[model samples]
Target: MHIWDVTNGARFSTYAIRADEGSGIISLNGGAARHVQVGDLIIVAAFASMSEAEAETFKPNLVYVDGSNTITHTNHSIPTQAA
Candidate 1:
């Protein structure tokens, strides 16, 4: 997975997820955690390579959460951005 630090304009940094005793914790460790401050806006994105045909048929499951990190909803598509 790649973590993009949106607040600091940093490029993606590779990372491995570790299972924590306290579930539902989103944290950055090691060198990547050096520059990130608490409450920074970061995006964790994952990707998989597949054939073009497979890609066209792929629909990612998007999950939505509330401020408390509770899942509010989920769907396969996101609404279009307003013009």
Candidate 2:
């Protein structure tokens, strides 16, 4: 997974997912905090791998979230791989 910082346009690749939360909110820790700060806007993306045949037929789900990280809308689209 990768976390993209909205402020300075920084990208942090992380594998750790924190389970603890405060005020019913999940917070970033470790290396994620070094690139991300409090009240900073960020986009977290996770990817799944499949067989080549599955990839040819697989459709990815795109989630549109609001400022508070609430899912406002979603749609399915084919995944694109960069060269």
lDDT (Cα atoms) of all candidates against the true structure: 0.73, 0.74
- C-alpha lDDT (0 to 100) for residue 60 of candidate 1: 82
Per-residue alpha-carbon lDDT of model 2 for 1-83, expressed as tens digits? 88888888999788855654432344677767788777777777788888999988887788776656666888897467999
Question: Which lDDT value does model 2 have at 67?
Answer: 59
Q: RMSD to native for every prediction?
A: 2.5, 4.5
Q: Give the winner by lDDT.
A: 2
Q: What stretches of model 2 exceed 4 Å from their correct place?
A: 16-26, 78-83
Q: Candidate 1's residue-wise lDDT over 1-83, tens digit each?
A: 77777789776667667756436567777887886777777766677899999989999877665544556888897579998
Candidate 1 accuracy as lDDT: 0.73
